[model samples]
Target: MSEAGVSLEMSKGSAPLTPVLSANWGDPRAWKLVNYERRGGYQGLRTALAMSPDEVISLVKDAGLRGRGGAGFPAGLKWSFIPKDNPNPTYLVVNCDESEPGTCKDMPLLMASPHTLVEGAIIASYAVHAKMAFLYVRGEVLHIIRRLQQAVAEAYAAGYLGTDILGSGYDLDIMVHAGAGAYICGEETALLDSLEGRRGQPRLRPPFPAVAGLYASPTVVNNAETISSVPAIVAHGKDWFQAMGTEKSAGFTLYSLSGHVARPGQYEAPLGITLHQLLDISGGMRAGHRLKFFTPGGSSTPMFSAAEIDVPLDYESVAGAGSIPGHQGPAVLRRDHLGGAHRDPLDRVLQARVLRQVHPLPGGHLVAGPDAAQDRGRRGGARRRRQDARRQRPDRRQILLHPGRRRRRMHPRRGEELPGRVRGRLPRRPGMAAAALRAQHGLRPRGLPRRGRGLLR
Candidate 1:
C-alpha cells in the first residue's frame, strides 16, 4: 500500500492524516478573516500575485494537481487552454453545487473555512488571467452561501480582491451565485447556462468552457475543492505538494467518510490511502456490525464489496477497481444495513395499511372516530347477515372452501391482489390478521417487540 511519493511511515500504527484544506476546521470561528489570517491564510494569494500568470500555471502543472471533481483532469492544463489571443474577457467559475449524495465535503468546508476558498479563488483567477470570477454554490445551502458571501466581502475589504491586490496591480472580482438546486448544474456547461439566467442544461462540447464559455468567452470551470487546493500549492512549493500523494495524484484531499462508521466525517488525507487505513483512522464500523459494501464515490458510482476495501482510493486506483472516486466520499453500509436479519423499514410502514385492510381495530372498530366506527359496525352487521344467508345457500360454502376456486379481491388502497379473499380463507379476528399476513408472505417478526407485539405480531 505504500507508494513512492506517499509518506505512510510517519504514523505509529495508523495512516497519517495530512489536513491541508481541513487544517483549521477544528479552530473556533475559523470561517472569519481574523482567525483564518492568524493561521497564515491569504499567504498563498500573496505569493501568487508576485509571480507571472504563466509561471503560476507551470507551478500547478508541475505539482501534478488533478481536478477533484470526479474527472481528475489536470487543473493547470485546463487553465493553460484559454486562448490568449481571443478578444473576449476570460472568466473563472467555481463549481460548488455539490448535489450528489455523499459528496458533502464542499459544504462543510465552506461552512467552516470560507476564506480558504476565497484566497484560492483569487490565486486561481490570477493564474488563469481571469478578471471576473464566479463562485457558484448550491442554492439549498443558504447558510453556506451567506458564510461565503461574508468571507468574500472580507477579502475585498482586506485588499485581497479588487484592483491592485496587495500592490500587484492585478484586478479581479468574485461573485457568489446561488443555483436553484439542480443536480445537473454540477456539470460545467449546465452551470454556465444557469449563470447566464437561462434554464440549467448542458451545451455541446467542441467549443468547451476554456475556448467559449460563460457569456461566449473563454472560461475556466473548476470544482470547489480543486480551486481550494490552489492556494496551498502557491504557498508551499510544488515539491512540497508533490511529496504527499502518489507520483500522478499529488497533494492532500478531503475524504468524506460517512455511514456505519464510528467516526463519520471528513478525513483529510493524502491520495492513494486505502479504505482499510481510513477505517482504522475512523474507528471502524458500528459495534457488532461488519462492512457489506461501500460506494467508492457517490451513490451513482459503482459499489465495492468488502473484499476490495484495501484498494487505494486515489483517482487511478479507484477507477482501476471499476469505480470512480466521485467527490472522494465513501458511504459504508454494514451487513445489517441490507435488511437481511432485520425487518425492512418500508415493510413496517406498510404494515399499518395491511391492518387497515384486513383487521378492524379493537371492539370491531375502524381507525376512524367512534361515530364513523358505529356507522361502519351498522354497515358491517348488514353485510354479515347477507353473508350468513349466502353461507346457508347450497353452492356458496362449497365454492368458498375450495382452495383453487376461492376468489381473490384486489385491495382498494394498494392495487395488489390480497391472499385469497379478505372475507374468505383470510383471518377475520383482530390480531389474527397479522399472523395470516406473516403466513402468506413467509415473513418473520425480525423487528418485533420483546412480547411479540410488532408489525408482524
Candidate 2:
C-alpha cells in the first residue's frame, strides 16, 4: 500500500506521484475550500471524531509522528504531556509563526488549505481535550490572516467548528491571532506571553506550557504542519501512517525549496527524503547559480554549507549533519555581488547600555541607587556654582538620571539635564542631547554623519 492514503499510480515512464500535499499546489484555486474537499480533505477529521480521544492519540503515537517544529519531539508524546487532572481549560496552540528565516511551509499551507488547518485544529483539540485552539500566525502575513479568518467562518458555518461538531458532542473554538512580528515570540512560552498581550520574549520553560500555559492552563502547542498532518493520520489507520518514512520518523512532510532553486515551492515527500531528491523534483538550482551555503531549517538553526546537501531531511539524519532540521527545507544562499553590508547603529547603543548595566558601580552596586541620585544632584549644583572653574572638564557632560536613580556616563541623547544641572560642551538636542551623544558615540546612527556644520567649524 502507498504511504499517503492514495496508492502511487505511475504513468508508462514517469516518476511516481509526489503525493497530494504538494502535487496540486500549482493549481490556481489550490487554496480554495471547495478544491480541497474535492481532493479528499476532512476525511481524517471524520475518522478522528468517531474514535475515542485516547484511540486517536494511540493511532498518532503508533504512526511515529514527530513534531515538525524544529525540535522534532514525538507529537503523540507532546499530546500526552497535558495533565489529565487539570481543572483549568486545556488549549491547542498552532505555532503558525513561520518567522524562522528559511521556514516558509506554514504560511503557504495556511494560504492554500485553511480548512485543512481548521480541521486539524478540531481533531487535535479533541484528542487533547482542549475546548479552544489558537492559531498564532506571524503578523507580517496580512493576506494569510484574512484568508484564515474567512476559512474559520466557513468552518463554523459548515458545523466543522463551534459546538456539536458533526454531532460528536465535541465543541471547539479556534481564534486566529496575528503576532506583532517578533522572532523570539515563536518560542512556545513567548508565544503565549504575546498572546496574553505582553511583550514577545522567551519565558523560562520548566512549566513548559503543557502544565501551565496560555492563561495558566494546560496547553498543547504544535507547529502548523504538525497539526495539519493529523487529518491524514485520522483518516488512515496507524499502520497505514507507519508505512511511509523511517522507523523513528514516519509520514509525509512538506519541504519548502526557496532562494536559488529553479522551481521554489513546497515539496511533499516522506520524512527521510534527501535534499538531492527534493532538488530533482523541484527542477534543481537556478540557471547558473551554484549553492554556496544553505540553512537546513532557518537562520536560528546553525548554517550548513553545500557539503551537507546529501543529508536526509529527517530529524535524526539532519542532526547528524551538525545542523538541526527545524524545518525540512533548503534555504539556498548563493554568492552575489551586492552593496557593502552595514550594521544597525541602534544595536551598538543597546549593547553599550547592556554592558553598563552589567558593570559594578564605584560603591560595588551592580545597579545605580538613591545615593547615586543625591550624588548626581550635588555634582550638578557644584558644577553650576563652579561654571567657569570647570570649563575644561569634558567629563562633566556624562550624567544620567533615571527613575529613582542617577548614573555617570549618561546616554548622550537622554535629555537628562535636571533643573539645577550645569550645561556642558556636549552638542544639545531637544529633550535629551546627552543620550543622543552617547548613542552617536556608540555608532548608533549606522555610520551616518551627524547633522549641522558646527562640528566642521
Candidate 1 regions off by >4 Å? Answer: 1-15, 336-457
- Tens digit per residue, CA lDDT, model 2, 58-101: 88888888998888999888898899999999999999987765
By TM-score, the best candidate is 1
TM-score of each: 0.72, 0.70
lDDT of each: 0.73, 0.68
Residue 393 in candidate 1 has what lDDT? 23
Stretches > 4 Å off in candidate 2: 1-17, 23-28, 335-457
User: Per-residue lDDT of 6-122 in model 1, one digit per residue for the tens?
Assistant: 234422232368888998999999999999999999989888888999999999999989999888999999999999999999999999999666678999999999999999899
Cα-based lDDT at residue 300, candidate 1: 45
After superposing all C-alphas onto the true structure, candidate 1 shows an RMSD in angstroms of 18.8
- Candidate 2 has its poorest 10 consecutive residues by lDDT at 337-346
Candidate 1 TM-score, true structure as reference: 0.72
